[model samples]
Target: MNFSIARRRMVERQVQGQGVKDPRVIEAMLQIPRHLFVEEAFQSQAYGDFSLPIGDRQTISQPSTVGVMTEALLLQGGERVLEIGTGSGYQAAILSRIAGKVYTLERIALLARRARRVIDSLGCVNVNIRVTDGTQGWDEEAPFDAIIVTAGAPSVPDQYRDQLAIGGRLVIPVGNRGDQVLMRITKVAEGQFTEERLIDCRFVPLIGRHGWQEGES
Candidate 1:
């Protein structure tokens, strides 16, 4: 199974085909061997256009969705990024390619450990993974140039908004339990942001403080 060919095709067909025009994003999607991020049994489907389960009931986001969400960040390189919900760490990997550094958070211990191993194996030294609640944001690393939230939340978390550097972008999925709209919020000034809704999508709930309760459906 030659993953490079599959990755190219996946980018041309599923990602680029969706009008994701960032060259950096396309290159990152091509460079990352997405198959390694999944279990060996599911590696063959890693480049597929649809999402796949990665364990602990979380799903590795589909290629197009990842592309879309990432492209929305408008990363210009050499920026510190905060990623909530690292999942398989695939998103963080992409972020690492386009940003100077990436800090990702995963609440589930098992997922966080597995993702760390995979990220380390890929030699993505720019990515830093932490096991903890995501909605709190990383205050010590306050004012990120960009933030990407992988989970769907009922509403945007206030902490996320507060942690953005001026003119930084926060890309997130917000709405209900089963559906969400991708939103790009740019912090133009202190306590001021402008939002643009991108597309309709679905993702697992963001479980943490300032987000959905752990047991909520």
Candidate 2:
């Protein structure tokens, strides 16, 4: 399969057709080789519009979803960004092209290590990956300009709200296993938040403390 051709189709039919108009976001999605982030068996489907399972039962999000979420960030060239559920590190890689600094967390140790290696090999100096429960929200790097939760949670964790800088935005998926809604929450002021629903989505449950507990796994 010629993955590059499929990738271009994704950009034109899936991403751009779906309203992901940010030129930078589109360019990042187009430039990054999504196949490198997935298993060899799934390389042919790398740029398809559907999510592909990676490992540990986690899946990389669809390209269209990634593009829309990135465009929603409204990055101003140098924004500190936090990403939860760094599956395959694909989304984080896309963010590195636009954000100033990206801190991504993963619950699974093996996936985190592999993602770190791939990200570093690509020479993305601005991205940092850690093997930790993402629900905690990287306290040392609190007050990020933007936060993105790649997995679905029953509700937005309070810790994530605390980590946001005033005027910052968090894009997260909220709901149960089979159904979820993508929501954007802006930190309007200290202790005040404004929310807008972006779209409906289906995502794996976010696993960790302050999220779905380990026992649930």
Candidate 3:
């Protein structure tokens, strides 16, 4: 099957049809080869609307979910983005296309290694992947322009809020492990934030200090 054509259809039918209006996000989704981020056994279904396993007990978020989460960031260009959960590096690849830089964190070493190989193979140099607890929120690179958490957290992490630059946005899914609500939070000013709920989503548990503990999933 022609993955490019399938990718286009995915954008039209699954992503855009679901109400993701940002042209940049749509174009990024169109350009990235998501199949390369998953196992070859599942590559044929990579362009489908649903999420697929990427090993290490993790999954790539559904295409529409990635679209909605990315659109919520409203990235114009040249912004530093922190992606909490680099499973498959698919979301990071998308971010790399739309942002100036991407710092992604994944706890599972195997997953991180696999994702790095795939990302490097695709020449996504803007994405920097690290193996660490994502709940800490990459304190060394704090005050980011945007932060996207690809896992479900029980609540918003205070560290994430403190790391956002004024006018920065953080898009995350918050709720139980099996269900979640996507939230977009903007740091308008010091100690002042505005939040908007986007859509319902489901993601693996964000296991770390500020999220679900390990083995909880």
Candidate 4:
């Protein structure tokens, strides 16, 4: 399979065709090798317009979804970005290409380890992956320029809002476990944010203290 050709087709169709206009996001999508993030068995379908499981019941989101979410962050380079749910580290790699640094969290240890290995192999030195409950948000690295949550949550977690720098943007999917609306929140001032619904989407439940319990449906 000609992965480079497949990648360009993905960015042009699945990503740009989905209404993602950010040039940086488009370039990142083209540059990152999506096939390397998925398991060998699924590599052939990595650039397809759909999600792929990456073990531990988590999935690497579709390329278009990643592009849309990354675009909503409104990154202008040299910004610290926080990513909730590292899954396969594909999203973080894309952010690393555009942001100054990326701090990504994954609750599943095995998944985190796997994602870390792949990210390291790509030499994304600015990307940091930690095994922790992403719902709580990374307080030690508070005031992120942008925050992106890959999992679906019942509501926007307060920690995410509090940890966001004023003027920072947060893109998250909020709603029921089976369905959600993609939301773009911008912190305009202290304790003040403006929310915009971007699109309807779906994702696995975000499981953590501030999210759905492990046993909940």
* Clashes per model (N, Cα, C within 3 A): 0, 0, 0, 0
lDDT of 1 by residue, 1-217 (tens): 8888999999999999999999999999998888988999999999999999999999999999999999999998889999999999999998888899999999998998898898888788999888899989999988899999999999998999999999999999999889999999999999999999999999999999888997887
Q: In candidate 3, which residue ranges exceed 4 Å CA deviation?
A: none
User: What C-alpha RMSD separates each model from the true structure?
Assistant: 0.8, 1.2, 1.0, 0.6
Please provide, for model 3 over 135-214, each residue's C-alpha lDDT reduced to its tens digit, 9 standing for 90 to 100.
Answer: 99899888899999999999999999999999999999999989999999999999999999888888889999889987
Report every candidate's CA lDDT: 0.93, 0.91, 0.92, 0.95
Report the lDDT tens digits of candidate 2 across residue range 106-167. 98999998898888888889999988989999999989999999999988999999999999
Regions of model 2 farther than 4 Å from truth: 215-217
Evaluate residue 66 in candidate 4 and report its C-alpha lDDT on the 0 to 100 scale.
92
**Between prediction 1 and prediction 4, which has the larger lDDT?**
4
Colliding residue pairs in candidate 1? none
| lDDT for each residue of candidate 4 in 1-217, tens digit (9 for 90 to 100) | 9999999999999999999999999999998999999999999999999999999888999999999899999999999999999999999999999999899999999988988898899889999888999999999998899999999999999999999999999999999999999999999999999999999999999999999998898
Prediction 4 global C-alpha lDDT: 0.95
Cand. 2 TM to true fold: 0.96
Which of candidates 3 and 4 reaches a greater lDDT?
Answer: 4
The lDDT of model 2 is 0.91
List runs of model 1 lying over 4 Å from the truth: none
TM-score of 1: 0.98
Per-candidate TM vs. native? 0.98, 0.96, 0.97, 0.99
